[model samples]
Target: MVSDPVQQPHVPVLLRPILANVAPVTGTWIDGTFGAGGYTRGLLDAGATRVVGIDQDPLAIEMAQPWAGQYGDRLTIVQDNFANLDTVAGENCPEGVDGIVLDLGVSSMQLDLAERGFSFLRDGPLDMRMSQSGPSAADLVNTLEEGPLADILYLYGEERASRRIARAIARERAVEPITTTLRLAKIIEGCLPRAKPGQSHPATRSFQALRIAVNDEYGALAEGLMAAERALKPGGILAVVSFHSIEDRMVKRFFQLRAGGTGNANRYAPQLEEESPAFTQKTRKGIGPDDEELEINPRSRSARLRIGYRTDAPADDIDRAALGMPGAGDRKGRKG
Candidate 1:
């Protein structure tokens, strides 16, 4: 999940649009990125017979254990990546899921807890692994070559000063391994200008970039989207809430391609041949939070929702490059 700029308040972004799109929700559904269980609870309350909540984070599943019993069999919690959602959906509902929601927003629980290292606002250990397993941000920062490190920041984080940040990190780590979050934030800050009034913190983009690299979020999202296409029955709805530009672009393109529409970013460039139209889109454009939702949840400012309905066409593989995934499975730091 590429996190939102601000910590979520447990309000699922653009949920109203989802519920309205699939009003009187019924049958089985999957909350692919079950963070705080906000989308799960919403679907349950809105009338879904069962919501199979899937998350790779152990902490998220553990936290849900206390109240999950109330829903009993109506709520099934699975600790796994959404990329494997098709397998889970098959086990839970042999027929097919009625709906699948992939809210790619990071949980506030992870952000508020400084120990998770997702936020640069509070000092903590330099660990941003969502599953809390595998190489950490510290491992990448302290060990990755400067060129690769700069690439992560530039491509994944979209930071223009990635090389400068990489040089600073190399210099600082040579003195001592950068183990803490604040220390890394300080290193990034020194390379970029300080935040001006309404602008985001200097370290925000770098931190997001590092987190994306550590978790392989872009790869997972690309896989998960195809997985959703395969798992959904004809007429099943797939709704995605993306927080950043790259992710939003990805969702938009996926829908366009699957719906037999143009997926090209550059309209002036030659357009690729349309596909078999595996899905029909809810709207041609992505839906953002309305004024009312924005008033209640300012953290949702960057959130965008795109919904698509599955068709009878068989699911097919898509080029990660077509999805605009960073590295395009070509990054030296992490291979897809």
Candidate 2:
């Protein structure tokens, strides 16, 4: 049986910065990721009149049953991806929302459960589907071609040993299906050097790549940013917290592009037309965990928070390439 996530306490990362930057949080707010109900609860406590919590994982919605009723009508929980947050907002907050909070990447609650297979340390089934349906990590490891698999590890995870790892996976899977977390982790460990003190696990990159592929996380994030633009009222706030460099890059590029900062870095290059800024940011460099947060939650070291306030400018179409998504401009993507 799977262990209950509630058994392990979850500490929301950068919650203080989000509340501070988007101060006096009011009106309807949407917690796009809604993992562990941390942001949702925080928003409500911080003065939001109403909060909509959205999550792709059914287990998340199911697990909230015990505490969800405490908020009464002030909190609404929905089962869906944040990419469709605008659609969900249309039905819930037709007038648009005052704020939206997105905590990207896998949640700690999900990682703690051995059955979720998000962590190699736990040694669970090789299933890493955030939505708990469709293709899983095992499916890709077993069936995907070495080239595509390598692309996923290299591009998505930024794993330099991608080719070597893929070759090992291919060889090991041929002998027997890579059906468990430890078995696949062993394969990746064989390819990469053992970690030094305080370094991440050898299988970290491979697991991250597989999870992203299985959940279509990058595609969802690209769409979700656009949806937030359309769904926010003028002066509304959108706060995003991202983990890892790839996710931070995408968020940084999205904020820069939407704020009309997208331009040729070359001083001599011809200037491209800039769109009317849809959002404005106070922190151009983004915010990270302070010393206090670091002392309390060591996992937050990689987390970065970016804030954007919506303007009255009309929502516009954004090319996926503009956001620096892994498989975007190069047109090289991983697929089964």
Candidate 3:
């Protein structure tokens, strides 16, 4: 993997916009997915007296520790998934944070390290665990039944050829267990019809699906959102930069429900509002990276950021059924 930046890479996608929206300068803050501590550094530079950095990847935590020392008690890094942000933050910053920032999806460092098995473009092990301990992609593809396998590809990858791919996987794994990234990528590609000249690689979607399933990315996102809600004080800001449709939709719904408040769909029925809405929408619409940033960081192209301010209400259970988002049970394995 690339060493710590000689300079910042592409300005940490939507940094300026998030700074403007969240205004994280003079209080405790949380950089929930502290990939390389870019956002945390920015927050501290903005005058935040204390910032807690949380990440599932131990490597990220290691990298962030030095920054904590440099910041001299103003910064601390925790090794854990952002889903546990509430507990972690309460322990680290009992006062609660003024702002929380989450930059979702695979980090550049993770994808850049071929040995980590995160990107199909760089063949490595079939493992895709962000924490490097949970089920690997190989484990899922070789062990899951065809039906559930198909569901994972369909739901997480959003691939249309889910059934065909899953069937091919089952057939191949019956002969031998899928073991490596390249092997699985090849199996996914072989299951597809020949691509047209301008079409994308057939394995793209299936690989993505397996990675998401292996890491439970969406599940973590949902839990992290709820945790952030619990960790923030009233008027505290929450900012998220999502990379895909699934994540973007989840964040959109979460912000809308918390900020807009609950109400009855039927006009004839009596409507009830909580003592206080959980949050207020800070950004009327999700913001994207500017053209200049996109030009330098292609990965920033897919990022969509939404910001919200916590309201004076207690945190509530996330309505997974209503949100159409995955649950922890769903993240443990394949789901079509």
lDDT (C-alpha) at residue 129 in model 3: 82
Which pairs clash (backbone N, Cα, C closer than 3 Å) in model 1?
none
Error in Å for residue 60 of model 3 = 1.1
Model 1 earns a TM-score of 0.92
Please state the error at residue 312 of candidate 3 in Å: 1.1
The residue-by-residue lDDT of candidate 2 on 36-130, one tens digit each, is 99889988998999999999998889889999999999999999999999999999996579999999999988998889989998878999999
Highest TM-score scorer: 2
Report the C-alpha lDDT of model 3 over 1-336, residue by residue, as the tens digit.
Answer: 434432445358888888776553779998988888888888888888888888888878776655468888888888889999999988999877888999988787777777777777777778888897878888898888888888888888878778888888888888988887788888878877778997767887887888888888888888899999989998898989988888888888777677764643224334445445798884568898888888878778879999888888888866554444643234333333
Model 3 scores what on Cα lDDT? 0.79
lDDT per residue (tens digit) for residues 35-123 in model 1: 88999999999999999999999888887877899998899999999999999988887757999999884677888778888889888
Ranking by TM-score: 2, 1, 3
lDDT of each: 0.86, 0.88, 0.79
- lDDT (0-100) at residue 314 of candidate 2? 96
Model 1 poorest 10 in a row by lDDT: 327-336
Model 3, residue 269: displacement in angstroms? 18
- What's the TM-score of each model vs. the native? 0.92, 0.94, 0.88
The runs of at least 3 residues in candidate 3 whose Cα sits more than 4 Å from the true structure, single-residue gaps closed, are 1-11, 65-68, 193-200, 261-275, 326-336
TM-score of 3: 0.88
Clashes of 3: 4
Q: For model 3, where is the 10-residue window of minimal lDDT? A: 327-336
